[model samples]
Target: MTQTENSQFRIECDSMGEKQIPSNVYYGIQTLRAIENFQISGLKPLETYVDACIYIKKATAIVNGELDCITPETSKAIVEAADEILAGQLRDQFVVDVYQAGAGTSHHMNVNEVLANRALEILGDEKGNYKRVNPNDHVNYGQSTNDVIPTAIRIGGLLALSRTLHPALDNAIAVLETKADEFQNIIKSGRTHLQDAVPVRLGESFRAWAQILSEHQNRIYVASGDLMVLGLGGSAAGTGMNTHPKYRDRVVEVISELINCPLQPAPHLMAAMQSMAPFVNVSGSLRNLAQDLVKISHDLRLMDSGPKTGLKEIQLPPVQPGSSIMPGKYNPVMAEMTSMVCFQVMGYDSAIALAAQAGQLELNVMMPLIAYNLIHSIEILGNTVAALTDKCIQGITANQERCLEYAEGSLALVTALNNHIGYLNAAAVAKESLATGKSLRQIVLEKELMTEAQLAEVLNLEQMSAIRPLGS
Candidate 1:
């Protein structure tokens, strides 16, 4: 053949090649090549993406079956194929790169191609044949990239919460609880402005951490519930223009059943398509969780401050050598990593907010960016929480000697003795004890303020460590 004819034949053959893609899809090598060429975000397709593909396949089959677009046999074949993909059997067939800018068109096509191929296999037909089942016409019958992308995002978000975030949060809570119980009797000096303020049991501090994490668990649940309310039937522009009325609710039911997660339709399709309020809310909660992690990591670092001169109230597990020059120096590397994760989540939150703000009237073209940011936030937070709980929190051991030493030297203990003796007299006794290098008990004894028994009764350890005043 001549060069021109040979080139034309090769192009036609490649266009109809028996590749991973199904035949009915308009998306071809050009679309896949464009996505692969413009690699952007470092994140690959996450579990949420996989979950969304499964959800779309199941929901589409149910919708098409209900609308008489496909017979029960066809629906069953499509769902079986989708289940195979969902079970991770056909992952290699999904060949689109992770970074495309056209509102996840590449991802949608990837899912379409994979499902179509699997459905054709179930129907005993070769891949890339539109005879038995077409990718767009049969698989993606009544959906658009707009509705599918967002719905998939919601499904992915919910799955992340259930499978990753909740478990990690639970682990952290368990570690905190265990620490609280272990350190209930260890008294330490509490600091407010980075200066000694009062006496507090080490357990009380851990309990506070547990409480913050529990609150975040609740926040995540609320945010995830918002995600559960999906925009399933809002095809193209929230009008359900080409989709049957029954298709909307039936698809939702199928999705809800397939994922075993409650899925609801939005009351207003236009509002659901145009407003990214759920994303904003979920991202805000993630930011709040990140802020809590920052505070917790900071406190852990401070508590594990110095092996030589700092607070040194608690010791963190040394994962590796901390310093290059100092041979014996160990650092709180897990705590530091936790802090870094917090900053990353904070950045993701900012990205989500910016994407939300950029949404327009009919539909948000920024759904892909929103999904990318939120998934990153969820995965990072999940892994960080797990690391903090397993590596840092569980291994933390209170520095009993240092805690006792600091508590003994702290003047805040005088507050307990002040109630029995007058404040001026207590101050005078404290000043004398410091100057004369004597204990407060010794100063009080020398001044004949009260008998040793009376002093002991009034300045008991229990009184000094109480979280609140005796009654009020």
Candidate 2:
């Protein structure tokens, strides 16, 4: 990026005029215009998105070669250039901002320029030799910014979910499952409306969290199924104009083979062009997951709120110091991180919903922003979940004695007497326990409601927190 501009730079021309591009980079004038035009986030698109673009480029070359639209030699050079990109070389060449032109036209052109220049170099031609391997004419044959971008976003999003996000989720789920088993014997006072209610095993909470992740993981896979249908051969407007009749299937075949995922042409090209429902569906699942995580993180933070006075039922591992002035203080930084990530992901979900609705006429121009938000959210959640699992959830320990003390003193334990003693008698015992600041057992025995043996049999602590509550 610090390379000095010089007269030796290659001159590239487009519809606008000619400009000198850096000699060392593969990008061209269009990419340069895009870089200077939208500097909005300073951050570039994710590498998965870049790889998706490469998939499209490689597939297009293969299909073009088979169709005899371009010489096999030209296809070979283009594919080789794209291969380098897929393999993580020339990543800096994709310089366009994620917030660029809504249709991602700038990015699509960036890909074309990079591949064209590299192909030109492979053909023993100088840079900017458009006559040899023009970026648009030869490299981007039978494609448009519209179809190409939407398809790439799907490809990239699904790739991120399977390749990165899901693995992180699995790790978190495994940690939860292990913790659930470890804490199965630890009974705690369950809170309803923030008031102590009845006995419940701490293990159940962990199991529920694991189940939430497992369910939502399935939902993501189901939503991503819609991504398999692509609108590739639907040139400019999805009318399939100027593309060969078999080009759609052939391109999909080549892409599927390259990515090792089964893919098919969109059932309806025009509808696919204008509709972003697939991305929305995927984001919906993400939104659900984020919402659930927010709740889980908050609950963990509350449980870990104080070693002195708060719920004190659990202790989140202290990954960092809580305050600058306070000694012997540590905070639930991991839980706080997951909570923040969940909020940001929910915000992204809202934006994706709005963008999906913003589509109009033949194409949705909101794709660039959607792509940025969706893919970024996916990656952030993946990393955040992994951190929480490693630094917080896995290291968390239950305050077993504290939990038992709360359960022993709770006035709510009087509910267990309702079956043996009359309802009125049980209610009186509960009121007496609350009024005298005495334990439920003390009040029940003092009231002569039942003998100690009957009380022990009827008020079985283990039975109260069992999978099936007694008499229910």
Candidate 3:
């Protein structure tokens, strides 16, 4: 249809009043109100979240049909319409901003309206024909925005973690393990407080980082499991007044079968609806991932700082020209991007924490914001982890000669002379090395603190890197 043809509209009404809706679209009056009301964030709902909600509605319809709550034809239409949504069709029909009302009522209705109209179309009807396929009466059935929004958020979050975040993290771990093995022999000067401390294998640091990321992956998996305990059957205030007594368990079973996840009804409907701690827990795990990622990026930046002046221990692949005016200059662009993304994910975690705490008597009103922050944080961090692994970590090159040179020259090597020369004499040797610009071995030999053969044995690069290096 031409833009002018789509510009034609049909009338739709609700308790508030009536409005003209786009004649060619599936969404109806309430969704239109939401688009106008919550224009705060230009972001749309995550497609996974919208699909999760559709899955719930579809499961509800199937259960309702088996229970004789709705006719077989109505169930068939709703199921067919929802299947289209699950198949990734008409995804653009979800129009509410990620920033919306506390209960996410607008978004819940948005899904209902779209499904109702499309179901009508499947039954040989036109759009906005609510009398034949009502959004609230038929599409929403026994569900409320309070129950559906949070339930869908949990489902969507779990699906994304399983499909996107976990795999990316695994890829990162594998890449880091490869780098660790590749750099095992590259001994480098380890720094404490930005000052040289002692020798360490370059591969050891990468191995440590990989271990930290692996622990975070376990945390996210546990949190995602907590999300499986859902509050799907709890309508409005969680009293189970409008819904059939058996609807909750049956619908949960249907949904679990549909999504192939072991979803269960929350033990207490009111408590589950009011508390977002589960999501907060998941967000906290994501923040931990961001923390580790920030550390890794900073380490890369510091190690790759300068070819002439800085540590210059490793080289990150130059993905782009770093400076506009500096001739032939390259930057650690991936590390820089990773650091910025880490900061953003942490910020998102703060919003999720506060929103999780902002719930009141019966329902959390900040779900829209929470959903927005949670999904985006997971998605961006996953994408960054994959990018950092493939584009930077996998391709990094250790400056073995520079690392060995720095380790051999470091005044901290005087630590190896502690038993031979005594603490006081070893301190004197470190001071002499720094003062005279001579390597620790040269200073020790010149000061006659140890013989050349003793120095070689005590200050062996591999020996100094050990947890306990012999001094004598």
Top-TM-score structure, candidate number:
2
TM-score of each: 0.88, 0.96, 0.95
Candidate 2: tens digits of C-alpha lDDT, residues 1-472: 1123564577777889877788777999999999889988888978988888899989999899899888898999999999888878888888898888879999999999999989988999876777868888888999999999999988898788877789999999999999999999998888899898888889998998999999988898898899999999999999998787888999999999888998998999998889999999988898999999998999999888787878889988887789999999998888888989989999999999998899879999999888888888888998888888988999999999998888777777878888888789989878877787887777778878789898888777788887774886
Q: Which stretches of candidate 3 lie over 4 Å from their true place?
A: 1-7, 446-448, 467-472
- Model 3 Cα lDDT, one tens digit per residue, 1-472: 1123455888888899988887878898889998999898688889888878999999999988888777788888999999999998999899898888778898899999999999989999888877777889888888899899989888888777866788999999999999999998889998999999788999999989989999999988888888999898899988766888789999999989988998888999888888999989999999988998999899999999997888899999988998989988999999999999999999999999988888888888999888888888888898899899889998999999999988887788877789899999989878877788878788778878789999889988897885543874
Off by over 4 Å in 1: 1-27, 30-33, 93-99, 417-454, 468-472
Give lDDT tens digits, candidate 1, residues 221-275: 8878888887878888989978887888888888888789978888987777788
For candidate 2, what is the total of clashing residue pairs?
Answer: 0
RMSD values, in order shown? 4.0, 2.5, 3.0
Worst 10 residues of 3 by lDDT: 1-10
Q: Judge candidate 3 against the unseen true structure and give its global Cα lDDT, from 0 to 1.
A: 0.88
- Residue 103 displacement in candidate 1 (angstroms): 2.5
- Where model 2 places Cα greater than 4 Å from the true spot, the runs are 1-7, 469-472
